[model samples]
Target chain A: MKLSIIGVGLIGGSIALKLKEKKIVDFVCGIDNSQDNLNEALALNIIDEKADLEDGIKNSDVIIIAIPVDATRKILPKVLDLMSDSQTVMDVGSTKAGIVESVKNHARRSRFVAFHPMWGTENNGPKSAIAESFSGKAGVICNREESAQDAIKMVETIVESLDMHTIFMNAEAHDLHTAYISHISHITSYALANTVLEKEKEEDTIFQLASSGFSSTVRLAKSHPEMWVPIFKQNKENVLDVLNEHISQLKKFKSALEKENFEYLGELIENANKIRGILDK
Target chain B: MKLSIIGVGLIGGSIALKLKEKKIVDFVCGIDNSQDNLNEALALNIIDEKADLEDGIKNSDVIIIAIPVDATRKILPKVLDLMSDSQTVMDVGSTKAGIVESVKNHARRSRFVAFHPMWGTENNGPKSAIAESFSGKAGVICNREESAQDAIKMVETIVESLDMHTIFMNAEAHDLHTAYISHISHITSYALANTVLEKEKEEDTIFQLASSGFSSTVRLAKSHPEMWVPIFKQNKENVLDVLNEHISQLKKFKSALEKENFEYLGELIENANKIRGILDK
Candidate 1:
């Protein structure tokens, strides 16, 4: 199958590479507004060719929107307008609700599949793409009933070929669960990084004394603002809910520490260790 | 040189393995309160032999205390009392201020070097020890002036042999830096894990939609409470201070989302990305 992936950055480039590695796509074309990104993607062989939106959508059997959520909302409908009944379109954005809402009543809505591959790293751009980025990860196909069966099956087959498990959820449930499990993680990491940067004046000391725990906890702080800002905006209510709870939890930790309540702190950590069961699954 | 490491668990067992791999110590002995840990260390060939603490101290030229901070504080005096001028003693615990204060005026204080290697995973015990655990990591040598120059040199040589860098800091400075960089990371992770567990009811969704970002952010929540509780108690003030700032930062993120201030949220993330510079250093 021929595929045209927009954005042509990390997730887009990675999908292109994986599809070609699995021999699932005959040709993978890409479109990016940034000339540098387009050049980098082509130079890295992440895309077989580059084309304009009109030509790309008209020619490819599949069109994948892999840009930031804000851009996805703006560009998704345009692609849907040109899509044929035989062509399938899917989005790999982190947030699903806003994008789905925008295209819900479109004439070609049946051709559009809303998806979120539950995988990413802090880095971005074409160079950040890796061969095993999505292997062993889960892919969420939101509001599957909204898409035609053929479009759903094609997207599922592609995700399955990448060795990823596929799960179906409505847009609301997907956004809520993501805010709890995924979006809050980035917020915590960013705030944790800012806290350290604020309190720890000696940058040299941080570089010298940083342990693996610190690195792991602050890893997501390196994520791109352009990518995450739209996500927080799109899933505002759920993200706000989790962020409030996270702050409350930190305040309790602070109070416990101030009171020297080692027993309480220990209990909190023990309870937190229950995440191991879910993670180990 | 003959070396004996007390507590033959993750940190101690891994040190033994690396020392043996590098052929730096002629004979390595291990002593642990848990028979299972000692047996695992022996089966893994992480040590050349196993012995009681008294026997190990009496026979070895160098001794390493690699237990929990509370255990280290309790056992350090006994180790110091048994040490001769020719023997060197060191510790690999997370907190340094309390341990340093405990042995401040000891007669053999000059013979003891307080060190903490900035490396570890969420797993613990002998079974969790890996051969390459400390390679390319930093080893903090706290209050080196309290240690005899020869002893400090010997410890530094061992750290260097393991392909790790040695950094110097006073005990108080070590505790404060660790609270900011290491201890706080664990607490934030534990609190984040707890927050998700409390808010999200769909356990299966969490397991399926969890991304690498979530895994990295929550990784330290899996750390053993037995290992971390004392560290938090020992560095109570610094941890509490950083924890307060962290909570405030999260609150700022929440308010930005609640107010639909995308500009502020974007700036917050962009500022947080400054951590990438320190991390890359």
Candidate 2:
């Protein structure tokens, strides 16, 4: 089998590496616009070969769009236009509703499947790819019925090769749940990073006093802006709804402190501790 | 050498385990208020024997007070009263200002060294203790001048045995810097957890869709309230100040989203990305 991957960054490079290792795909043709990324992916043996976008798509059995959500939205329709009826295409985009909507009325719409792999790190670029990163994570496929059975099965096979369990949800529901589960985390981490940067002038002190807890909370602050801005733009309303709730929740903590309500503060923490039940699940 | 640990929880149990492994302390006496914790510590080999507080202090060469900050503040003076002139005492309290002030006028003030080790996880209790957890972490000795030379040497030896480097700071600076770096992160984690729990009613969806980034950002929400409420109560002013700054920082991202300022949003994330420099240091 042959797979053509678009945008050879962390997610794309990782998928190619894993599929090749599992012998699911005999060849992986990396189709990235950046010459540096292509060179890095090739040198690291993350892909069997680097090919031009048009040639890569025409020769492969499947095509994976692993670019940023904004770029994916703009390029999905064009890719679908280029693919033959026998070929299958799937996107590993973070926001699904927009991508699914962009190719909704296309003649080749059924050839494409909307998929999101629930795994990531703060780092990016081809060099940051890890084959083991997605082993225990979720791979959500949205608007499953809109795609042809063959396309859905191909994506499911790819997800299984990556060692993730499959989840089915409509495009709208995927966006809503991701807003609460994923998008808001990046915003909080970025703000927490900026808070310490703005208020704490003694950089040496911060470097010395930082604990493991602080590092974990702000780890996502290092994520690329190019990737996140488009996600926030595409999922603006849902993200805003959650962000407002998050701010209000923080205010509850603030009010508790201001009133010197220790008991109330303890209650808030105890409520938060309930996350253990969900996280440990 | 012999050591007495007043509270056989995460920090104290960890300290005893490391000191014994390094052969710096041949015997350890546990003095936790809860019989369950003492039993668990003994079963896990965290402490050699359980002893009464007064008897334990008189027999040991050094004493470690590792309870909640509020409890430490109340018990510090009494512990100093029991110690002989040659014996030394140190605390692994999260907040230092209150603990230092509690024994300021005591006749044995110089025997108490105010210390805090910069390491922790969401889990607590002796069962969560890991001796290697302290390696490569910072151990801050606050108000070094207030401690006697012999007392300082004894605490410094303990830090070395834990395989951590020592950082010296005054009590006021430790509280202030920790508010910016450590204390505020917990509040944010607790708040983030509450935000998700309140808004995302579908527990299964959250369990299925949660990315590593969300889990990382909210990991500290699982910390026990018995430990945190006292830390907040002791360092209320500093925590409140940093919390206000953090809320304002989050508002910047909200305003950018509300105004549809993608350029400004990118700028905010790019600024947050600067944290990589400090974290990687």
Candidate 3:
């Protein structure tokens, strides 16, 4: 099989490497607008060749869109228009509702499968790609019923070959749950980084006194803004909903602390501890 | 030198192990309110023997109080009252201002050193202790002027021997900085955990789509309430001030998302990205 991957950054580069390593793709070609990214991906053996999107779509059996969420919405329909019934196209963007809706009425809608692999790091770019990036993580497949059976089966086979568990959900449900579980985390981290950076003027003291818990909580603040800004925009409503609730929760905690209500603070923390049960599952 | 560690739980037990492993102390004894914790500490070889507070204070050359903040405030005065000029006493608690103020005018204040080691995990109790736990972390020695010169020297040597850098700060400065850097992180995490748990009812969905970012942001929510409650209460004013700023930051992000002001959101994230400089330092 031959594959064409768009973006050619962290997720795209990692997918290309994993496909070649597993012998699932005989040749993998990449399409990226950035010359530096294309050159780096080629130097790292992330792709067999680089080609334009038109040539990539015409030649490969599969085309994977791994760009930002807004870019995915713009380019997915174009790819769907160019795709044949025998070819498959999939997107690995974080938000699914917009892209899925934009392509729903297209002639070749059945050829597209929307997927989100629930794995990433604070780092980005082709150099950040790892060969075993997706192992042991869950890959969400949104609106599978709209896609062709063969396309769904092939996507499942590819994801499973990379050692990922697949879960199915509608685009609306996927966006809502992802806003709660994933997007809010990024917002909280960014706010936390900003809060600490605002007050702790002495950078040396922050570096010296930072504990593992602080590091862990603020790790996502290092994520690329180009990629995340589009995600926050595409899923604006759900993200805003969760963000409002999150702020309210923080206000309650502040009030409790101001009142010196240790018992209430303890109860809140204990209730939050129930997250262990959900995560441990 | 013989050492006695009060409150034979996570922090105290870990310190005992490191002292024993480095052969800095000829014998290690433990004193805990809970007999089970004492037995567990002994079983794990965190200490060689168990003793009451008075016995431990009188017989040992050095006494380490590693307990919750409230307990530390109540116990430090008693320990100082029983101390001799040849013996050094130190308390390892998260909040420094309250503990320091509680013993400020005590006659034996010169024999006591107030220290806060900036290292810990979400897990607690004796079983959570790890060997060489405080290595490479920063140890904050608060109000050094209140401590005898010899006591300060001895405590500094012990912290340095554990491969840690010692930073000197007054109690007020220490509490303010810790509230901004450490305490606020925990509050945000706990509130975030509760927010997500309240909104996302499908536990299976949360388990499936949750990313490393979510797990890291919520990790501090798993911390024991008993360990954190007193810390919050002790540093209530500083924690509330930082918490208010944090909530205001989140509200700004929420409004930006609500208004679809991508430019403002982008700038907010870009500004937050400046944290990389501090973290990398």
Best by DockQ: 2
**Candidate 3 residue pairs in clash (backbone atoms < 3 Å):** none
| Candidate 1 residue runs with Cα over 4 Å from true position | none
Top-TM-score structure, candidate number: 2
**What local lDDT score does residue A193 receive in model 1, on the 0 to 100 scale?**
97
lDDT of 2 by residue, B90-176 (tens): 999889999999999999999999999999888889998998999998999999999899999999999999999999999999999
Window of ten residues with lowest summed lDDT in model 1 chain A? A247-256
Candidate 2: segments with Cα more than 4 A from true spot: none
For A1-281, candidate 1 gives per-residue lDDT tens digits of 89998989889999889998999987988898988898899899898888999988887999999999999999999998888899999999888999999998899999999999999999999999987899999999999999999999999999997789999999999999999989999999999999999999999989888888899899999999999999999999999888888878877778778888888988988999999999997
Candidate 3 accuracy as lDDT = 0.90
Pairs that clash in candidate 1: none
How is the predicted docking of candidate 1 categorized under the CAPRI scheme? high
Alpha-carbon runs more than 4 Å astray in model 3: none
Query: Over the stretch B114-159, how does candidate 3's per-residue lDDT look in tens digits?
Result: 9989899988888999878898899999999889999999999889
TM-score, cand. 2 vs. native: 0.99
DockQ metric for all predictions? 0.86, 0.91, 0.84
**Residue-wise C-alpha lDDT for candidate 1, range B212-244, written one tens digit per residue:** 899999999998889988888888888888887
How displaced is residue B212 in candidate 3, in Å? 0.8
